[model samples]
Target: MRQAMYGLVLYVFLMLPPVANLAESVMTIHMHMQMPLFVIAGMLMTPFLKQQFPRFFAKWNSNGVPGIILFMIVVIYWMIPRTMDEALTIQAIEIFKFISLPFLAGVPLRDSWKKIRLVGKNIIFVTLSVICGFMAWLYIFSPEQLCNNYLIVEQITLGWAFLFLALSIMIYFVQQFFVDRSECE
Candidate 1:
């Protein structure tokens, strides 16, 4: 209950014009921070949601893969430059961004994560890293602005951000692999 309230508060704060405007002003912040914050808020609210709709999850996302897949789809959709532009311009899309990130992606992800095996988790991480790398390459190399709301420079910055993220993920996985191998010896 307390966590859910906190999540609600976070959702409200993020929705506030000044904060929203600030986050949306930067291409990287808009995609990486503001968008994920919605997912995090939903993550925080998962316990309450799970309690409220136990049967629904059991029936639809029994193994968790479906839920994670759905979450991934939502995330991948938002990563598109056009989708980000639509979020800024279309009220309906913006609203969907708010609702879908948390409820559709976040909640399900939290529930599904526990059910996923180590290999599955790694697969997800690898996929995300590839996505980041691809986005980075596109952003950095493209001469034209992919998102109308942002400048080309901002797009480049976002590209750098994506590159950094991909590298970080790769580093973490490599470190984990080494540690696991050492432990087995």
Candidate 2:
């Protein structure tokens, strides 16, 4: 657990400069807020999950559903977008790579539907909280910049974000189903 936390911290610190630059260029407080929030939320959730689902955490397979879905989403977006800006595309690719830790920790720890639902609820709460915080930040810190035209915020597009969330929920359900079948033996 310590190692995992260290790795996550290291990953964030290493990626901070690029992400900060992206936020600066985009002038999107939300992007900056979400980056750290997502990392911290994922990290904090790990121990709670381990405690809640000890059996699942005991045999962690290192294969994660969230990481896979994140990767695929980035790839698909890159392929389909009419004109992908090089910097944003590169940043998304890198961010997707860095998100692997949470996914790896999440997948095999889903030994039951109840636990899966709990995780999903946590994720939703984290995401929504971050969004709200970002909104507040924007209102208080840079109200004028909110309407800037040159600021190209690279947020999770509305459709894509929903899809990603759905995929995660589905993965949890699938994991639960498999675990249930195996336990029957």
Candidate 3:
């Protein structure tokens, strides 16, 4: 299970740069279609994940640590002014959806040796991939149209995405060091 998760993470990271470049070249309509397909793929994987990783689910059921942290971050950000501005707020919401990918993907591996480490690593890589993809898209397409009336939401969302990615990377490295030290001791 750990190997599989690690493989998936590597695969996603490797594929992202090319995918982003391809997305930049493709017609806007085609890109739009592809984005939702990725979402569908995630949704479809849920059942298989549950069947394969019952132990992880058990861990998730026993602990609310991840969810609680996510909630607190959201709430704290909400309290800050300008965060609620339309564009940034929408971006923040979009970022939340992106971050969900790791939690959902990692939920099935909670009790395994990799445990949260696997999740953290995968999340960090995936988030970085996404940010890179977006940067590519923004640079190439430069779509002037705002999906929402407020542009602040998009800024907030980007900020949140970076924060999540950084936090995940930090946790992953810290856990890895501890695990390595424990084994040595």
Candidate 4:
């Protein structure tokens, strides 16, 4: 209950014009920071939502794969450069962005993460890393600006950000192979 209230507060705060404007002013902040924050707010409220609609989650996501896949699809959709532009230009798309990122992507992600096996989790992580790597290459190497709203320099910065994220994921994967769970525990 308390967590849900906190999430609601975050949701409301992020919706504020000043905050939203500042976040959206920067390309990287809009995509990487603000978007993720919305999803996180939803994740924080998952406990209450899960308790309220137990059957919906269970019936639709018995093994967690379905929910996670939905999460990935929603997230990937938002990652598209054109979608970001549409969200800024079109009011309906903006509203959908605010609503969909939280409910569509975040809720299922939190629900599915706990239920999915470790191998499943690893696969998702690796897939995201690969996607990030691809996006980085696309943004960095493209001669033209990818987003109309942002300059080429900002686009390059976002590409570097994606590169760092991909590299970090790869580093984590490498570390996992060397770490002995028995020793740590």
Candidate 5:
């Protein structure tokens, strides 16, 4: 409950005009910071939601595939450059961004993650890594501006951010490969 309250407070803080403007001012910040924070806030609310809507969640999520699909769809939509631009320019899109990122994407993601098999989890990681790499390549090398609201340099920075994310995921996998579980035991 306390955590949920904190999440709600954080969400409110992010929604403040100055804070929102600052976060949206840079492409990298908007994508990496604001977007993930929204997701985190939603994740924090998951416990309460599960408790309140156990039957509904269980019926809809079932084996978690449906919820995971919904989460992925929302994530993919937000990843598009046009969607980001529209979120900034269009009131409806902005509202949707605020609502969907948390309720639709984050909440479902938290619920699904626990239910998915190990193979399914790995698939998600690989899919995200590929997406990050592809987006990095597109943003870094494209001659044309992908988003009208941001400058070329900002796009390049976002590309680097994506590249860094991809690298981080790779590093995690490598670490997992070499970890000495036997020694720990």
Candidate 6:
């Protein structure tokens, strides 16, 4: 309950006009930092949401695959540069970004993480890493700017960031093979 309240607070704080504007001012911040925070807020509130809608979760996401799919869909949608532009220019899309990131992406991620097996987790990480790598390559090599709101330099910077992200995820995936999580537990 306390965590839920904090999440709610974070949700509200991020929605504030000044805060939103500042965060969105930089393309990298908008895509990487601000967006992830929204997901985190939703994850923080998962306990309360699950408590209130236990049956819904159980019925709809029995094996966590459905929730994980939903999470992936939301994540992939946001990864598109056009979608980010649409979110900025269109009020409805922006609203959807807020709602989907937290409720669809964040909540499901938290709920599905424990229910999913290691193989499923590995698949998700690999898929996301590959996607990130592709996006990085696209952003870095494309001759024209992908996003209308941001400059080519910002796009390249974001591409480098995504490249780093891909590398980090790969590193984590490789490290997992060496570390016995069961022993740590």
Say which candidate scores most in TM-score: 6
Question: Which ranges in model 2 have alpha carbons more than 4 Å from their true place?
Answer: 1-5, 8-15, 23-158, 181-185
Which has the higher lDDT value, candidate number 4 or candidate number 5?
4
Candidate 2 Cα lDDT to native: 0.44
Order the candidate numbers by lDDT, best to worst.
6, 1, 4, 5, 2, 3
lDDT of 2 at 168: 58
lDDT of 6: 0.95
Best by lDDT: 6
The C-alpha local distance difference test score for the whole of candidate 3 amounts to 0.43
lDDT of 4 by residue, 73-154 (tens): 9999998999989988998999999999988888999999999999998999899999999999988898998888999999
lDDT of 2 by residue, 7-95 (tens): 46755654587754555354233233444344454555566556777666445423344433443344334322221233344666545
Regions of model 1 farther than 4 Å from truth? 180-185
Model 6 lDDT, residue 155, Cα: 94
Per-residue lDDT, model 5, residue 75, is 89
- Deviation (Å) of 70 in candidate 4: 0.5
- Residue 90 miss distance in model 2 (angstroms): 25
The residue ranges of model 4 lying beyond 4 angstroms of the native Cα positions read 181-185
Clashing pairs in 1: none
**lDDT for 63 (candidate 1):** 90
Lowest lDDT 10-mer window, candidate 5?
Answer: 173-182
Tens-place lDDT digits, model 3, residues 1-185? 45445544543542364653454233331123333333334434444575777676567544544533443343334323233333134655535533443334333223222334546555645554554455344433444532333344443454444455446655665666557665765
Query: Candidate 6's error at 2, in angstroms?
Result: 1.6
CA displacement after TM-score superposition, residue 51 of candidate 1 (Å)? 1.2
Candidate 5 clashes between residue pairs 3 or more apart in a chain or in different chains: none
- Writing each residue's lDDT as its tens digit, candidate 5 over 153-182 gives 999999999999988987775676688747
Q: Candidate 1 or 3, higher lDDT? A: 1
